[model samples]
Target: MSATQSYAHSRQQKLVVGFSQTPAPTTGLTRQEIRDLSLKGVKTRAASTAGSGRLHGKVAIITGAGPELAIGTGAARLFAREGAKHIYLLDYNPAPLSRLAEALREKYPNTKASPNPMRHSRSTVDQDGVLDLAVSALVDQAIQEEGHLDVFFANAGIIQRPPKRVGGGGDEIAEELRATGRNMGGIEDTEFMEVLRVNTLRWVEAGSNISYAFKSPIHARPWRAETLGIFGLSVFLGIKYASAAMAKTTSNKTKSVPGGSIILTASVAGLKANAGPIPYSASKAAVISLAQTTAYELAGSNIRVNAICPGLIETDMTRGAFEMARMAGKEGRMGVLNPLLRQGLGVEVAQMALFLASDDSSYVNGQALPVDGGLTASMPYIRPKL
Candidate 1:
């Protein structure tokens, strides 16, 4: 057996595998930064995330597609743009889900709709058989109308707290840990368990080879990669167990939809941290890296996979920043703190998400693409004399 050399120093080792280019791109800088001094003052849109129409006319099920678009809705809309006829939009919060569904209904009148059986009424992770039963129900619903589940957006996740400030000065260590506990473990046991159920475990159980999960940070600093493993290894292991269970399922309904795909949602915190809890940053970093490992392990079944690393898009997770900055104008804060000097809209990240979910990204596997408007790439001067 050939010994595998450590990738500790190679540029390739630092890169997320299967992306068109290594390390993806930061927020403001294009994949190619020509650095035109004359054009520095002008704004230029990068090539469309909707490149080449990958998800056209395919069916997709997007979980937690709340109006606020915590993660998956952006991609769902892009899926519609990609020609998806049936969109199964699901979410726990009825108000936003209904509103977003209404918007989508207006956008894609021709597309069939079955709004996820109304959560918790046999649709929530809280219900014991709900996850498995709902999985079959949703897939069956699609198969019944659309013939088969063509594209699956396993983007169901929750980041519950209203949002809190983290990463204070040297005097704030204790407060940071306290804040992290809330992020790591919810105030209510049921809520916390529910977080793990939806945010971490369900995609594995649902035959979704890919998933995206994120949360509000309790700290604003990066953690050693191992810390993330401790938090998320259970979910990765859960995926293993879930895959085994699916192998033994009495039915193999999804046998015709080609193969499985998973895109675990992570954040800039994972790779680069501006300010947040250690657990949140560490776990997110783990989410992305573990996805790399999982991509390697689960490759036998034609299951392509990847990750979506988003920065301060409008969501419950980053409300605190909004509170600190104030107004829609505060999108600048997302960029201000970030090297990119601009925050990203949910739709921006969503498009990239749809690509990974659809066959358009067939060659793309096990990568982490950042949608933070260049947040991670820019670092602030700390030492005053570096």
Candidate 2:
């Protein structure tokens, strides 16, 4: 057998042995112990496929990869480890963007990493145009440097805690009120609009720009849309533009596989009420709907669209929430509502994205897969006397 085949065989053997020795945790273990085992499973899988090259020779663009532990950065890191040829990292902050780019380069010397600092503000048409222009420039740079773009991860967004005028004051006040288990009032119109603009409108604009680039005449081959995963609450617009973009086909008579995938980062809030703020929950609900509707619409075109609803994940955006819970001596209660009984990490979400991005999910599409430890399996409430 060839070297590549032999190596793959060895890796398969190792995985089989690993699974045999570490069978799925049973109910005999404590919930915490089970959660730890679940996390260990993820780590083992990652290590086993450390150099598997799932994305070999593919070029990708990942936005909102600012925080080191955020989902976007996590996806970017995993993409590189999986053998993406080149990656263009975009973020509003230069520091984190540079830091992530540096780390990727250090670890994956064969992969090219470029960092771009682009802000997403939609107060004015001019500002919106700026975002469009920035996205266009980044896509252009990727094409110029790498010759083609395979994956576009539109994962940048902002989560607004209701403004003080709405009910709670600042973030601290909001967290304090939430800790006391009091629901805040609706957010002010201005605050709500701002949040919608940044979280929704901006993503639509960026996704369109990237899609346009993919259909541009400069690219010679039929663009393969691996995964267009978006992060944040703006699942509606994110899925809309991304699916539309992926569905666009080249005019050339010759046909290729014509495969594409759109993965939206939805939240458990979208699946049920009482999981998040009013506006946030509403937006996520729209996202889930978009994923289903778009998947149906694009099925004929060989493009698959899906949404991933995550439960309590510990990331930069949720740092405050996690901190508050820990300070209240309820740290272990973070994801107690979920069957897993523990919070998830960003990489866990990345693993799901990778699956949706790869050919393994070619037959799977148009579904809102939940990676929330079975949080959405049933209506969340106290079990009454049986």
Question: Judged by lDDT against the true structure, how good is candidate 1?
Answer: 0.51
Off by over 4 Å in 1: 1-53, 116-137, 143-147, 160-198, 201-257, 273-275, 327-331, 378-386
Candidate 1 lDDT trough over 10 residues, lowest sum: 121-130
Predicted model with the maximum TM-score: 2
lDDT of each: 0.51, 0.62
What's the CA error at residue 182 for candidate 2, in Å?
A: 6.8
Q: Which candidate is the best by lDDT?
A: 2
How many residue pairs clash per model? 23, 0
Residue-level error in angstroms, candidate 2, position 332: 1.2
lDDT per residue as tens, model 1, 1-386: 11222222232223222222223245454322322221232223322333355655555666556656366667666676666767776555666666666676786676655344644322222112225455545555555555545455555544433234554453243443355445444455444444454445432322223333322111113433343422332334333322332222123443443454555677677787544454446556666776687667656646655778887676655555555556444323234444333456666777677778676677887788887766566443332233
TM-score of each: 0.60, 0.71
TM-score of 2: 0.71
Which digits, one per residue and each the tens of the lDDT, describe model 2 over residues 184-289? 4545655555555555543232443343232322222332223243322233333433444443434542223454566677778878878776656666776677
lDDT of 2: 0.62
lDDT of 2 at 20: 23
